[model samples]
Target: MSFLPYALAAWLFFVGLYGIVTSRHFVHLVICLGVTQSSTYVLLLAIGYRTGKKAPIFTSGVPVKVGAVDPVVQALTLTDIVVGVTVAALLLALVIEIWKRAGTVDPDELRRNRT
Candidate 1:
């Protein structure tokens, strides 16, 4: 119902994009990418949120007629987080390898040194 969460997600996404655009080091770039990816979690939570609804889990006392939040959204958010962490780890490993070989993590320096 409210637009605040959507606005926050958009703000986070843009901030991350700006950081990525201005980043000089590979590690910093990877961190920015992670930040950008986090916005999706906020967006997903917002979409699944219900003003007065209960969680998707149902118990004996809880009536089936009562509204429940979307479980699929929660699942997707969890999956997204897992994928993001995996991607971040892989990117960080690649950055470490680059640093080991190139002696520098700066993108501009890498470009200059590239054959």
Candidate 2:
């Protein structure tokens, strides 16, 4: 069950990457990034859901013997979210800049400007 989510997320991310790479529209690329991010978040939450573990809050009256989910992964997910947002923001800013400078959002056009 745990591995299923991870596999699905991996597959979804692959599809998103394919779309992003083949996409002719900048909007489609951004949407694919969001899709990839959501799959990763789903995978993270699924991994965190163990069989019968208590909350990870470390309360005073908890008596469960199950191992808590790795807080490192949780923190990583949060950091990933922040980084994803930052990247999307930057991409949007770049798109806006491109539109202002070239009046087009085609990746091919942007690449042509490189040389």
Candidate 3:
């Protein structure tokens, strides 16, 4: 259980990379990009995870302890999620435009259609 997230993250990253490398369509490529990016979130959270630790919120009586999980990584992971979603959305929009103009999303077809 302890090593699960780390292993999953690595597996997800490789799987996404494989998808991107073998992608035929622009949308597929974008989706693979998202999968790859998600692996990083898993990794960041896993790295920041501390067993049996409470959240870092300040309380009147709870003493601050060294065992508290680092909050910075959690924050960074959240920001990464927002940024990644925005970028993926923008990319999908571009793909939609390309499909509208090209009548296809296949990368090879688009390349051949290039004037």
The C-alpha lDDT values of all candidates are 0.93, 0.81, 0.91
Off by over 4 Å in 1: 60-62
How do all models score by TM-score?
Answer: 0.91, 0.77, 0.87
Best by TM-score: 1
What lDDT tens digits, residue by residue, belong to model 3 across residues 31-76?
9999999899999988988888877677799778766777888999
Per-residue lDDT over 80-104 for candidate 1, one digit per residue giving the tens place of the 0 to 100 score: 9999999999999999999899899
Reference-based lDDT, residue 105, model 1: 98
Ranking by lDDT: 1, 3, 2
Compare the candidates by lDDT and give the number of the best one.
1
Native-referenced Cα lDDT, model 2: 0.81
Position 7, candidate 1: lDDT: 96
Instruction: Looking at model 3, report the run of 10 residues with the lowest lDDT sum.
Output: 62-71
Model 1 clashing residue pairs (backbone): none
